[model samples]
Target: MGGRDVATASIWDAAHRRTTVGLLTLVTLVAFEAMAVGTAMPRAVAELDGVAWYAWTFSAFLVTSVVGMVVGGEVGDRRPPGPGVLAGVVVFAAGLVVAGLAQHMAVLVLGRAVQGLGAGVVIVLLYVVAGQAYDSRLRPSLFGAFAAGWVLPALLGPLAAGLLTTHVGWRAVFLGLVPLVAAGLVLLLTGAPGGTPPADAAPWRSRAGWALLAGAGIAALQYAAQRLDLAAAGIAVLGAAALAAGLRRLLPRGTVRARRGIPAVVASRGLLAGAFFGMDALLPFVLTEQHGWSAATAGLPLTAGAVGWVVAAQLQGRRPDVPRQRVLRLGALVLTVGVAATATVAVPALGGWPAYLTWGLAGVGMGLGMPSVGVLLLDQSPEAERGANSAALQISDATASAICVGLSGVLVAGAADAGGPLWPAVLAAVAVLTVPALLTARVAGRTVAPAADPSCATNLGR
Candidate 1:
C-alpha cells in the first residue's frame, strides 16, 4: 500500500499512453457537450417550450453517473482500465446521437441519463488509469494534461454549440460527436487482440441491482424537482433506498459515512464538485435572463478561466513535490470567492459581469483543484486497488454533482414562482456549498502536508 506498491504503479506506461489518448478524446467530448449545450439550451428551451425540464436533463446525466462511477470503480479494480474506457465512449456517443435525434423532452431526458452512465464509466476509468499507471512524479503531469484536455470543451464548446444551434439546429450539437468517439475507439483498440480488456466483471444481479437503484433514484429526483407532491416524495424515498444498496455494492466500506483518509477524500470530491458544478449549471440562464446577453457573449469569459486553469495545471505538474491538499484549499478559497461574488448581481452597473466573473473564476478554481485531487487520490491508492480506488474518487464527483444539481433544480423552480430574482437563487445555491467547501478546506489543509511534509504548506487551509 505504501512505497513498493506505489512504485509498481509506474510500470504500465504503454497502457497509460493508450488510456491518455482515449481519455483525452473522451474529455474533449464531455467538455464540448457541456459548454455547447449551455449556450444552445436557451434556444433549445424556447423551441421545446419546456424551460421547466432544463435542469432535470442535466441532472439526470449526473445522477446516473454516480452509479456508473461506483460500478466502474468495482470493475476497474477487477480488470484493466482500457476496455472500460472504450465501452464508456461508445455508450456516451450513442446517447449523444439519441439526444440529437430526439423528438420530445422526455426522450432528451432519457438520452441525458444514458449519457450520464457513459460519463461515469469514462471518468472513473480515466482516473483509474492515472492512479495505477503513473507514479507520484508522473501523476501530476497526467492530471494537468487531463485538465488541459478539458479546457478545449470549456473554451470552444459554447461558441461551437451556439453556432451549431444558430445555423444547423440544436440537434447538430449531438450529431457532431459520433465520429470522434468512433475514431477514438479505433485508435485505442488498434493492435490489440481482444479489443480493450473485456469486463468479465462481477455477477449480473449485482450490477442490475445497482443500476436499478441509481437509474430509479435519479428519475425520482427528477420528478421531485418537477413537483413536490406525495407521489414524488414516495418515489424519491424508494430511489434513495436503491441508491443505498448500489453504494453498498460499489464503494469501499464507510464511504457513505465519510470515514477517515481515502474515503473522506473521495467524499470530499463529490461534495466539492457538487458545490461548484450545481450552481454553474444555471449561469447561462442567469446571464440571458438578467443581462439579455446572447449565449456567445455570456460564454466568452470562460476563456479567461480556462486559460488560468491551463497555466495553473502546468505549474502544478512542474512542481512534483507540491502538496495537493494545499492546492485544493487554494482552489476552494478562489472558488468560494467566485461563488460569493454573485451577490454583486444586484447592481445594474455591473450588469451580468458579476455572473460572468463568478463563473469564470470558478473555472480557474476547478482547474487548480481537479487535477490535484486526481493526483492525491491515486497517490492514496494501493497498486492492486488503484483502478478501483481511482474510480471511487470520480464516482464521488458524479454522485454529488447529481444530487446537488437536482437540489438546485428544486430551488430554482421554487424561486421561479416567486419573482425569479437571480441573486436569490444564486444565494441559495452558494449557501449550501459553503459548509462542504469549509470542510473540504480543512481536510485538504491537514492531508496536504503529509504528501510532502513541508512546513509552509502544512496549514494552508487551517
Candidate 2:
C-alpha cells in the first residue's frame, strides 16, 4: 500500500510515536519544575533570608539562559540534536542536586543559574528537533501536545510542592525532580533521531562573548534595581549599553524595532513574556506578603491560570485555520484586560481573592498567543536558520522577562524598605509594563513574512 499522507497523520502514529512521547515527557518535567519552584520560592527565600533579593533568583536563571540559548542554537545548527540534549540533561540534573543541598540563598541562586543554562540549551535544541522531525502541518498538533504536557503539572505541581515544602522541607522540591530528569534522558536517547546538519548551515563563529555580555548586563541591571543610590543610575546606564550591544549581535536585525515579519514574531514573544511572567514571578510574593495567604493558598491562582492557558492552547491547535496574527492580537487584548482587573487586588479593600479568576483570564491570553507565535515562527523560518531563529525567540523572552521582573523588584524592594505594602507598588509597575502587550497587539499584523520560507539572509532586514 502507498504510504499514508504525513500531513493528515496523528502525532501518535507509529513512525512518530516514540519521539512524541519522549518530547512530551521532557516538557512535562520542565513544566513541573517551573510550577514547583514558583510555589516553593516564598518559603525558600524566607528561610534563606533572601526576601530582599527575591527577584535575583528569577533573573539569574533568565540571564544565564540567554547565554545558553545562543550557544545551543549555534550547536543545533552545526550538529546532531541528540548529543546536545543529553549534555543539557546532565547539567540540569547536577543543578538540581546543588539546589537541593543549598544551605544559603547564594548557593540556591548559583544552582538556579546552572539550571537556567541547561534548560536554555535543552529547550532550544528541542525546537530544532521538532522542526527537523515533523512536517509543517503536524507542528500545531505537536505544539498543542507540548502545552498539554503543562496541564498535569499545572494542576498538581503547586499542591505537591506546597505539601513538600510544608511537610518535608522545600529542599525536596528540587531533589525530587532529579530522577524524573534521568527518565527523560533515557526516553530522549532512545527516541531522538540522528540527522545530518543542513547543508546550508551558517559558518560557526563564537557568539559566547556577546551572550555573556548580555547575561552580565542583565545581572548588573537587576542588582542596580535593588539599590536606592546614585551609583545605581550609573550602573543602569552601563548595563543598558552593554545589553544593547549584545542584543544587536544576537537577535535578528530590526527586532528591537519590531520590523515586519520574523522580527515582529520575535518581538511579540518578548512583549507577551515580559508582561505575563514579570507579574507571575511576583504574584505568590504579593499574596504571602500583602494578603497573608499560606504558600499553598497562593499557588491556587497560578493553577487556575494554567488551566485557562491549556484550554486556550488546545482550542487554538484544533483550529489551525485561524490566522495566527488574529489570535495573537486577541490574546494580547485579553491579557491586557486580565492584568488590569488583577491590579485591583492591590487595593487594600478589594480582598485579593478574585486573582484566582482574573489571573486565569491572563493565562488564556498567553495560551492563545504563545503557541501562535511558535507556529508562525517555524512556518516562516528556512530549515538552515531554524535553530538560530528559535534562539532569538527565547533570548527575547529571557531578556524582556529579566528587565520587567527586575523593574518590579525595584519597586517592591523600595516599598518594603519604607515599611509599606508591596502589592500597590507591584500593581503600578505591572500597569506600566502592560504597555508592551498593547504595542504587540497593535503590531501583530507585521509578524507575517513576505516570502514563503524566507531564510535569514533575505528575511531579517525587511
Candidate 3:
C-alpha cells in the first residue's frame, strides 16, 4: 500500500472512453450540487430562519464527508467500488428529496447531513474510479476534465439558484436535482461495465474508527462555531483524539508537514484550498455588508471565478502533453496574482471590479493547479490505496478550509457584533488568504519541474 508500489506513466489512455465518461458524469453531479446549493441556501435559511446554525449545515456535511472519503478509500482499494458508488448516489438523491420536503430547520439540517455523507462517499469513489480505471498517462487530462465539469455550475449555479429561489422557491432547487442525479446514476451504472478485476484482498482502513473521527472532529468544529465556550476545549480534544486514531494509522508519514513528494503534494493542496476557499467564504459577506450589494451581486465574482476555472481547465486539457511541474508552478504563480489582487479592492482609486478580477484569476489558477496536484498525487499514490490517498487529499481540503473559513466567520461575526468597520473585517479575511497563496507559490517554484505530460503521475524524489 505504500507509494513505492505504484508506477508512473506518460501519454493519454484512449481506451477508457466509457470509464472516463462515467467519471465525468460523477464530477458533473458534484458541481451541480455545489452550485445549486450556493444559490438556494440563502433562501432556504431565510425561510427557515436558521441563520443561527448557518455554518453548521456546511460544517456537518464537510466533517462527515471527510470520514466517508477515508472509509471509501479503504473500501475502494479492496473490492468493487461500483456498488459503493451506487449506494452513495442513491443516498444523496434521497437526501435531496428529503431536503426539498423539509418543514423545519432541524429536518433540513438532518437532510443536509445525509447529503453530506453521500457527497463524501461519491467524492472519494470518483477518485477510486479514476485511479483504478485510467492509466497513469491519461490521469492528468482526466483530472483537468473533472475540474472542467464543474464549470457549468460555476457559470449558472448562482443565477439559476437565484431564479429558482426567488421565483420557484428554494424547494425547487432541491427538487430540481431529482432528474440530474437520477440521470447520472443511470449513466454511471450503464456507461461502463467491469473494466478491471476486483482487488484480491481487503484493505485495512477501519470504518468504525474513521466514522468516529470524522463525526467527532466536525461535530466539535460546528459546536465550537455555535458558541466560543469552554466546552469547545473538551470537544476539540475529543475530535483531535478521534482524528489521530483514524488518520495516524492510515495516511502516509509526514503528510501534515508535506515531508516528501506525495505528502508534499497533499499537504500543499490542503493549505492552498483552505486559503482560497476561506477567502471565498468571506468575500461574499464583504460585498453584501460593506459594499451594499445584493446576494446575487455578491455571487457574480464567484461566477466569474468559475468561468476562469473552466477556461483554464479547457486550455490545460488541449495541451495534455505539456510539462506538469511547469504547469503546476505557473498555476501557483497565477494563484499568487489572483490572491494578491483581492487586496486591490482595498485601494480607494479602484472600483469594485478589482475584487471580481481577483476571483476570476483565482478560478483559473485553481483549475490549473488543483487537477495538477491531484494528478501528481495519483502519480505517487500506490494503486491499492487509491481511496486512502484520495481521502487524504479531500480531508486536507476539508479540514483546512473548515478551520480557515470558520475562523474568518468568527472574526467577521465578532467585528460586526461589535460594530467594527466592515471593510476592515473583510481585509482581515483577505490578509489570511494571502499568506497561504504566497507560500504555495513559493513551494511551487521551489518544487515543480517540467514534465512530459502534466496529467500523469510522477514522483521526483524529494
Best by TM-score: 2
Runs of candidate 3 exceeding 4 Å displacement: 1-17, 41-56, 166-169, 193-203, 226-250, 423-425, 445-462
Candidate 2: segments with Cα more than 4 A from true spot: 1-4, 37-60, 98-111, 150-155, 165-172, 284-296, 346-349, 412-427, 453-462
What digit string (tens of lDDT, one per residue) describes model 3 on residues 1-462?
Answer: 234422333223334565666677767766777777866887888988888767666666666676677667766777677888888888788888888999877888878878877888888888877776666656777887888776776676767788888998999888888788777767666654454434554436376466657566756765676566688667767766766676665466777665656666777787678777887887777777766779778878887887888788767755655655567767877877887778665544454667888899998888888888877777766667677778778877777777787778877877888886766766777777777766666565323323423333345432
For model 3, state the Cα shift of residue 117 in Å.
1.4
Clashing pairs in 2: none
Clashes of each: 0, 0, 3
Q: Judging by TM-score, tell me the better candidate of 1 and 3.
A: 3
Best by lDDT: 2
Tell me the TM-score of model 2: 0.86
> What TM-score does candidate 3 reach?
0.84
| Model 1 lDDT on a 0 to 1 scale | 0.69
lDDT of 2 by residue, 98-191 (tens): 8889889899989888988888888888888888787766777788778778677878887899899999999999999999888877876687
List candidate 1 stretches off by more than 4 Å: 1-19, 34-64, 93-114, 165-172, 189-208, 228-245, 287-296, 299-304, 347-352, 355-358, 420-425, 445-462
